[model samples]
Target: MVILFNKPFGVLSQFTPEAGHKALDEFGFPAGVYAAGRLDHDSEGALLLTDNGPLIKKLLDPKFGHPRTYLAQVEGQITEEAIKKLSSGVEIKGYRTKPCIAEMATEPENLWPRTPPVRFRANIPTSWVRLTLTEGKNRQVRHMTAAVGFPTLRLIRTKIGNIPLEGLQPGQWRFVQEKVI
Candidate 1:
């Protein structure tokens, strides 16, 4: 079985516990499943979980090129040129990123507010962007946008591969049957 979860901000991606934080128990998952890829404790949104090891590998492996989409709220005004650069590729921490989709999103309607909301600065305007990456690198979206000069203020994953966080709220989950491609 495959599960698509809308992980809330500040939640660990693992079933394991960390000090001063909650675990999968707090999110309410049935025993025996594990996360396919991690979303940082500070970041939020769509995370996949399963008991099937091979399916997990195929989804998490970079070679499979499964697209994971995020809605990133960035600090400062972003230019169209910068969006193009992100779509093309950007060198972050010495390695270049694979080409990905980056576009401005209309203020995300019906987005559930994050617990302990992202920091806001009176001086800097924030823009919402939709970013899709096939590779699951450590903190990649945060690093990529920062490298491009518009630092990400908040990040949310809305979709993973063909599954979306539709109808799910933070800390909620639903069981889905695997789609045979």
Candidate 2:
């Protein structure tokens, strides 16, 4: 069985708890299913779980280049130059990212309010960016935005490949068709 889960902020991707953090077990996913990929504890959005080992390999392998789409709220107004830099790839932590689609995005309608909330700054402005990346790196989005002079204040994965984080609130999950994979 394949499951598409809407992971919430502050939740760990694994089933086992760690460092006092809430893990995927809290969601009550079925037995034998394991996460195909992970979202960070501080990040939120679509995560896939499955019992099929080969499916996990297909999703996590970098060469397969499964696209993961994210919506990031970054500090400062994002600029065209920054978008170009993101689209063309940027050096971060001694490695350069692969070029991917990066564009300005309006805040999504019907967005759920994050618990604890993103901090607000009176003097600084924030803007949204839509990024679709084929590679998954540790804190890559946050690192990329900071490298481009726009630090990410909030991050959410809106889609994984063709499956979207739609019709589900944080902590909600549903079985998905394997054909979509």
> Relative to the true structure, how large is the alpha-carbon lDDT of every model?
0.85, 0.94
Q: Which stretches of candidate 1 lie over 4 Å from their true place?
A: 178-181
Tell me the tens digit of each residue's lDDT in model 1 across 1-181: 7888888888898877797666666776777899988899888888888888998888777788888899999998878988999999899888999999999887677888977987888988888888999887899999999988999988989888778887898888888765722
lDDT of candidate 2 over 1-181, digit per residue (tens): 8899999999999999999889999998899999999999999999999999998999888999989999999999999999999999999999999999999999999899999799999999999999999999999999999999999999999999999988999999999975645
Q: Once model 1 is optimally superposed onto the true structure by TM-score, how far is the C-alpha of residue 32 displaced, in angstroms?
A: 0.9
Report the number of the highest-TM-score candidate: 2
TM-score of each: 0.95, 0.98
Q: lDDT at 89 for candidate 2?
A: 95
TM-score: model 1 vs. ground truth = 0.95
